[model samples]
Target: MYGLMSILVHSIMYTKFITPLGIDASLNRFFEARAIDHVQVLAHEIDGRQERRQGLKEAAEYIKAQLERLKERAGSNFRIEIEENAVGGSFNMMFLGHGISFGYRNHTNILVRIVNSYF
Candidate 1:
């Protein structure tokens, strides 16, 4: 009775102080219009003394909170989720997939991956 759609969001943090921010809502809109049903977030890295910057735990929590906020804002407009199980102090990523079968489902599939260093 429905179709299948997929959206992939890949994020890589190669240095210290990598900021893991949520994807923009406008980007979600684009994906929703395409009837995407799955979102894959690839967050790589954790507590590692790669650089003399903020604590790894602190940064991890910050990233988690940011993602939670996005889910709350999305409400029913989109079905977003985060995958936090990375290895080593390397990559950080986030992905959001939306499904809009009744409304717009013929637009572009947007993949918004926001990354920041020394934040």
Candidate 2:
């Protein structure tokens, strides 16, 4: 995903026909520098194990913080909503011999709304 984003940024920077609104050269540089930081934070903070529930919560918070930073930087009324739902009875091979047949976990759904008409 990070690679894809990097490719996309490069394409945008080089393409003559495509003009991203509110994204200048400086903002593009900012995103280029911070993109790896965002990925690193998510990878370290979000442990996708069923046993560690706090990791999911922390992941949601981290996403929120990143979105908030984006809103602040763009000076736009971008909105983010997170909806968490419980997923029950998920089967895992790791639990095969532990006598635990099923696992329950929470999944977070993130929605970002960019109010700009160009989007």
The estimated TM-scores of all candidates read: 0.30, 0.47
C-alpha positional error of residue 2 in candidate 1 after TM-score superposition, expressed in Å: 61
Q: Write the per-residue lDDT of candidate 2 for residues 1-119, one digit (tens) a residue.
A: 99999999999998888443433446524544366667887786577724556777788778877777666776444443434454545764545466555655566556776675446
Residue 44 local lDDT, model 2: 68
Whose TM-score is greatest here?
2
**Highest lDDT among the candidates is held by which one?**
2
**Across residues 1-119, which tens digit of lDDT does each residue of candidate 1 receive?**
12222222122233356344335446434444222322211123334423443445445555576567666666453566566653333333444654333322222222334433323
The clash count for each model shown is: 2, 0
Once model 2 is optimally superposed onto the true structure by TM-score, how far is the C-alpha of residue 55 displaced, in angstroms?
Answer: 1.1
